[model samples]
Target chain A: MSLETLSENRSFGGTQGVYRHKSQATGTDMTFGLFMPELAEHARVPVLWYLSGLTCTHENAMTKAAAQQLCADAGIAIVFPDTSPRGDDVADDEAYDLGKGAGFYVNATQDPWKPHFQMWHYIVHELPELLGDNFAVDRDRMGITGHSMGGHGALTIAMTHPERYKSVSAFAPIANPTESDWGRKQLGAYLGSDESAWRAHDSTVLMTEKGYPGEILIDQGSSDQFLDLLKPESLAHAMMARRQSGQFRMQPGYDHSYFFVQTFMNDHVMWHTERLI
Target chain B: MSLETLSENRSFGGTQGVYRHKSQATGTDMTFGLFMPELAEHARVPVLWYLSGLTCTHENAMTKAAAQQLCADAGIAIVFPDTSPRGDDVADDEAYDLGKGAGFYVNATQDPWKPHFQMWHYIVHELPELLGDNFAVDRDRMGITGHSMGGHGALTIAMTHPERYKSVSAFAPIANPTESDWGRKQLGAYLGSDESAWRAHDSTVLMTEKGYPGEILIDQGSSDQFLDLLKPESLAHAMMARRQSGQFRMQPGYDHSYFFVQTFMNDHVMWHTERLI
Candidate 1:
């Protein structure tokens, strides 16, 4: 539960703190952005976990994403973690979609990656314990959302452990990772060639096999460059086949980018607010 | 007016086009960001000029501001200009503040800078003319805003040419450059050590002498690290001395960073929206 302050700055009567903690799960140092809202006399607040996509650091979402105002208004603290462990010591690949940038939110049992690529364990198990122990976060009212590869992280994490997260949403998520090239490559490299092992990480397959206890919301752009890889319809079809009711929206003419995310970001915040309240 | 498209990307059913045009004032290539809203049959829209601070390129404010959604809602096109012209051929000082970044939005009559540091003419005359001829911006419905040094730019530019801009605003702006070290060094180097010459570039002095015809709005952070250099009260005192009606708000516990800007950015956008509409 020990946390070391990496950096801190003041904004809108709140403190934006960047902290680093040694993780036992991944055996690597992890960084996260925590914004403690200006609260009324000694009142603890709800928390929201935001995951980012490939080739991103903890600072990207914290600095660029205009989500703090909503979080402040809703009395929620936001936690932003680095996409994956990054250092000269950790194993990496040249491709942008695999190795360091592409943790895919799973505990790898494979060689080279087995030591420090346990993002699933770090995010789901260790992160919550550290946040609850160190910060004033109401763990009972937690929610999660992310973009692209991180969207896949949010979905898989929430579906696997619904009790831990009260609400869930995503933007331009890779709905079926096993069927997409980016997903297949990463999964084959990290989880081996066994197709059965891939299903546990695919949201569409997971939804079809084990229906989520609560409603899931997803927002995708019609003009996304990776629209073929996202496969939102497959997720919808799977939900419908299982008689599962959830909200899946397809926005017209938007793309897979921060601009698209910023357009619909406030809506996701409000959505989580309604459920968390 | 020849326009060269430097880059273009699809976001939110519209396109973000970055263009480089040969400026008649500086005789150097200048860049600006244009957000063309989802065009519903080609309607002319109001234009907003966003000037950046020290050591920033045109791309910084364009990509990081998150001002597109509000602009789209207000049906306004935003233009972000680089803080200063830059090239190996162009004049540069060893420090980050003096030669290139410290354009001060004035026509330099001093050595080295005189040949190319004509941002004043580039912004006030050349930019509007080129934009009016090529883009669908209403020439009469233009507004201006900026941050820190750029804030000084907006105020001075608007005050200098009152007929051109309809409204003006700023975030964490330098009110009086004549009194601060950064400003004194820059103005002295760019315009020589004459106090009267520096008055034309100082917003506080201009406010006391010429006075803006329209209402001026400014937002300052209480916890700003550069509060000594900013001197918001100088502008406030000048406004008071002239009985000029303007809005100057100071928020508590905010620093002199983009995080502070992002917090109250919606207010500035809405303020311009009210004026534009």
Candidate 2:
């Protein structure tokens, strides 16, 4: 419980806060943003976790997504966790897709990354425990969503722990990471060159094979510059094949940016709120 | 006419764009953000100008203020101009308040700043003319609002050109800039040792002496760290003395960040929209 409060602001009748903690899973100090709406004092509330994509920290979604007002209106707390474990001692790469800001939400099995690139453990085990112990988080009614690489994380994580998360959603998410260039490169680097090891992390694979009955939503931008890298259609195909009741939307003229996310963020918040409640 | 597009994104049924142009007034290439809500292909719309604070660029309000959706809903455009003219050749100071990003929205009369620090001309004349010439702008229906130093700018500009601006608003403005530490330092540096000359730029003086008969609104945070420097109470006193038609509110527990502005942004947008319409 070595957590520290960094800054807190009153936003939309809610508390927008940034905090730092000594993370056990990554062996590095981690920072995250939490937006908790005005609730009855000491009331436990359902929380939705939002994972950011490449070259993003907790600040990007927390500041740019315009999510607080919508989330506050929906009566849910939203969390923005850093994309990767970061520090001077932590391993990094010159490439934006593989380095500190690109965690890929997986435990690194390869050397030069194994020591500190353990975001899977940090997100699934360490961060949740921290929130549950320190904040008014209702552990039984938690939801998950993310953008891009974080989208892949949300799907795999929700499928992996179907009982832990109540609902899932994403914005321009990487649906079939095993088949995506971005996913294949990061997976090869973090989980070794074995393609079989990546199947467990791919949402298409999970939906087709080990499906979850919980609520699911995915919004992808039709005009996204990285559309091919996301391969959301592949996941849509898998969802159809497995009869997974997931909402898949291809938003036209929207790109892969917070602008696109902010436009549809209210829907996601409302969706999660209804399901969690 | 020397304008260039930097970037553009579709947001909340509008277009968020960044543009650059060689500014004759500042003698520098200036950048600004413009959010044009969806309109009939060639329909002109009312515009609300938002001036940023010290050490800030157009990006702060464009990305963080949560202004677009509200503006789009209200059928108004919003412009975010940088705090000051910026370039390697432009004079700058070590202090956050005095140099590049702290133009005080005044045309400098002093050396080293006079040549390039013509933000007053740039903002009030050059930018507006450019906007009117290039965009779907309804020149007759313009409103202005800003935060911190930019608040001071909005008040003074609207009062100086009351016939030009249909509505005016501010957030945590330095009311009496001549009496404020940040304002005195910045104004003194930019306009020289003539304290009497600074009266033209002081919002409190403008409100008290040359009253703005149009719609006026001010939202100040009580918990702002720089509350002493802002002196919203002074403006409230001036409003009372002059019988000015202004709505002034002290928001409790809110700070001077975008958090406060965003919390009340919808109200501002609606207020301006009614008057402009």
Candidate 1 chain B lDDT trough over 10 residues, lowest sum: B239-248
Segments in model 1 whose C-alpha atoms lie over 4 Å from true places: A1-277, B39-41
Question: For model 1, how does the per-residue alpha-carbon lDDT over A1-277 read when each residue is reduced to its tens digit?
Answer: 6799999887556778899999888888889998877872267777888888878778888887788777777777888888888778888999988888789888887878888899999999899889888888888988898998889999888888889898898888888899988599888888888989998899989887886776666777767888677776677556534434345555656788888888888988887878776
Candidate 2 lDDT by residue in tens digits, B82-201: 999898999999988888889999999998899999999998999999999999989899999999999999999999998889999998888888988978888888899989999999
Best by lDDT: 2
True contacts kept of 2: 0.00
Q: Which residue pairs collide in model 2, if any?
A: none
Instruction: Give candidate 2's TM-score.
Output: 0.51
Which residue runs does candidate 2 get wrong by more than 4 Å? A1-277, B40-42
Q: Give the distance in Å from residue B257's predicted Cα in candidate 2 to where it truly belongs.
A: 0.7
